[model samples]
Target chain A: MFDVSRVQKELTECNRDKAISGVSIALYEGGSDLSHLRGTITGPVSTPYEGGTFLIDIQLPSGYPFEPPKMQFITKVWHPNISSQNGAICLDILKDQWSPALTLKTALVSLQALLSAPEPDDPQDAVVAKQYLQEYPTFVATARYWTEAFARTSVAIEEKVRRLVEMGFPEDLVKSTLDSVNGDENLALEKLCSS
Target chain B: MAPVPASVARQAELLKQDGNTYFKKERLGAAIDAYTEAITLCPDVAVYWTNRALCYMRRKEWNKVEEDCKKALQLDSHSVKAHYMLGHALLERQDYAGGIKELEKALDLGRGANPASYMVEDIWQVLAKAKYLEWEDLSSKHIYRMHKLMEACERALTSFYTIEDSQVQNDCEEIASERLQQLEFLKDVFGKAEQDDQPKEVPDYLCCQITLDIFRDPVITPSGITYERAVILDHLRKVGKFDPVTREPLEQHQLVPNLAIKEAVQAFLDKHGWAYKMS
Candidate 1:
């Protein structure tokens, strides 16, 4: 069984300095299960991933703290060490190098650090890694584009939905379309038009 | 008949004596009541609070004991009884680090006050328990810190064993020995975790494709892919009943323990224990 008390303590500790740490954790919306959580981490400054707010799905195993937390990116991003297709991170701390002392906040901080420093040699996405190593400028441009295209869109959902509705699409349809395309206004409009 | 007038201090003294009498008679509630009355009469006296705390301790009321002890300490910081009681209360509450600090302070004050009156051996025994408990809490967190705590436990154990008090010696020895066994188990687990901090390349075949860690108990799936038994079992049970690498449909029974690979991993671990930390 999961140690609910420890998980509760970790959640409190992580959220206590959410503003300062730029990382916060909340209970996964559907249920009261403390084992599943939703985490948010602001991208580190002075990096291609900066100004992007990343959402992460966190699942705690029964042996959590003893066992490493299962974390994957819920928000799309472009990084050599992170799978562009599935968001599987290639950080050691998420796997065999995980220590029980590490909390959710620290793990998210590490993810932010990973954004700043991509280890292309130990790549999760081979194509991205190749691009990163062989076409440094192009890789930076593509990563910056992905962040702008995917990451920032979540913040403009209200505006996007309003604009789509003003363009004669139903409010509910606009809302669902925006969510389906991860809050991308242009894509949601195209999806609405196509439907 | 002569009318006798008692001063507030004298009245408090009389009440304290009554509390002591009740305490010796094992009437803890009555003892507490008497101590409360004494405190009401002499709020500035630290002894009343310490005496009440002792009564609370007898009743196994750790929080009450802690409160009274804090009150006593506030009145007179040098009160050894207050420190001792507070340490005992904190220990009972499993605040080992805080308890240890308070006990250490009591020991220091006890030394200055009167060495003969100090329960030196008992304090050492409690200190050892606190150190061992602290190590237990830290073992899962950080291997290096756990190693340091283990060393602290060892030092405390050594000191505990040297105390001349024959009354607690046997009990302390038993506890110390048990703690040592626990420490050995933790050492085995943490020794490997500490190695993770250092960069060491393992032979590729030694690592499980699923976990990317050296195998503890290697097992082969029907798909001909080898993995650590625990990792594969976890994947099968939770994630999916398929090969993590190949995505081939699989089941638990399809897993056969690869003894040859297991033996190799064992030999490797036996040779270099530090490389086997991911338990």
Candidate 2:
């Protein structure tokens, strides 16, 4: 059986240090099973991807840490190493380089690292890699534009929590309810009233 | 304590042995009689009283166990058996504070005598249960008191309609608001206490780097890297026969049980009873 306790510990530990690390993991669909998780990594500073928050979809296999967790980007990004059409990454750690010692936090951190240092030679998206190599300035402009359009100005999770808390529900209860509904404020407000 | 004659001491020792045999056979009545006779001959020795108290414990006579254990402690204050039995007796009688105090004392002495003894492990497990029970008892009482206070406030507000004086009514409204404020403060305190349910972090060395969990059966490989036995064995079988960290050639035969880390983990778990929920 998969080590649920270890994954639970990882989630708690990762979230506890998220403000500093700029990466966090939560249950996917707020389901009780530890198998599916959603990860968030803030864009690294001093990169074209700066000021963006990217979401990753994580699914654990039955073997879990013994086998690497399946991770994919949920947010669109223009990068050589990450698919622009679909958010599959070209990182070795996700495949052959995977070790049981590596945690979900480390994998997400590596994704953040990949954002800062994109490997154009070993590319997931040939078109983005070609743009990055042959026309560097245009590639930078497109990446920054993609980051601003897709990653920024879309996280309304905290806003929903604040609104619900202003409606006089406890902040913890409101935030958790918001999470359970995939951050849909209207559904969360409905849940709060009935609960 | 007065020294008994050598002949009487030898006879008491023989009687104590007979009592031990009866105890091993689960013959509590015969064991109690033998221990009583031993205590009569050797009243200065604490073992005789503690042995008789053990028989009382087996009989589920908690009061008798408490009495004899106290007598044993009077003869020899540092006897681990006497303190442990007294603690168990007090716990059975619902005296959590007294039970926990005696258990702690027994733990201290037992550790000083032999850290790895079975009695030391037993003492800590009982202590953890006692502490958890104490917490549950105290918290439930607190909750009941809060509920009662809330009910009283509601009742007082309902009765305010019977008063006719406008001034009295204003004063009553003010008191009711103040009571409501106090209730809000109490609710905040309870919320914080509920959040405090999260456990403290385990030490890094005690956890397996591979599994990121407290080690159950830790083994050190030839490369001097320690990993949990099952995880490492699985790695060798499924992944490759090498240490995940060092990438060194390793096999199951090269792994040895890491007794020191195992003992350290056991000691840590013994001390933090709340952590039992995690592992």
How do the residues A1-195 of candidate 1 rate in per-residue lDDT, one tens digit apiece? 755655776677689889899889998755788889988888788888888888898999887655779999988989998999998889998897664435677888999889989999899999999999999999989988888877787666687778888999999888888877778777878889989
RMSD of 2: 13.7
Q: Could you give the TM-score of chain B for each candidate, in order?
A: 0.48, 0.59
Return the top candidate by TM-score. 2
lDDT digits (tens) for residues A53-151 of candidate 2: 999999999987778899999888999999998899999989888878789999999999999999999999999999999999999999999988778
Cα lDDT for residue B201, candidate 1? 54
Q: If you assessed candidate 2 against the hidden native complex, which CAPRI class would it receive?
A: acceptable
For candidate 1 chain B, which ten residues in a row score worst on lDDT?
B270-279
Model 1 lDDT at residue B200: 53
I-RMSD for candidate 1:
10.5
Q: Provide the lDDT at B225 for model 2.
A: 84
Q: Estimate, for each residue in B143-230, the C-alpha lDDT of model 1 and write its tens digit.
A: 6576787778667755665573454546556776776786677667667766664435557698775445565557788888887665
Tens digits of per-residue lDDT, candidate 2, B168-208, equal: 54556776677678667766765665444435777889889
What TM-scores do the predictions have?
Answer: 0.41, 0.54
lDDT of each: 0.77, 0.82
CAPRI grade of model 1: incorrect
Q: What range of 10 consecutive residues in model 1 chain A has the weakest lDDT sum?
A: A96-105
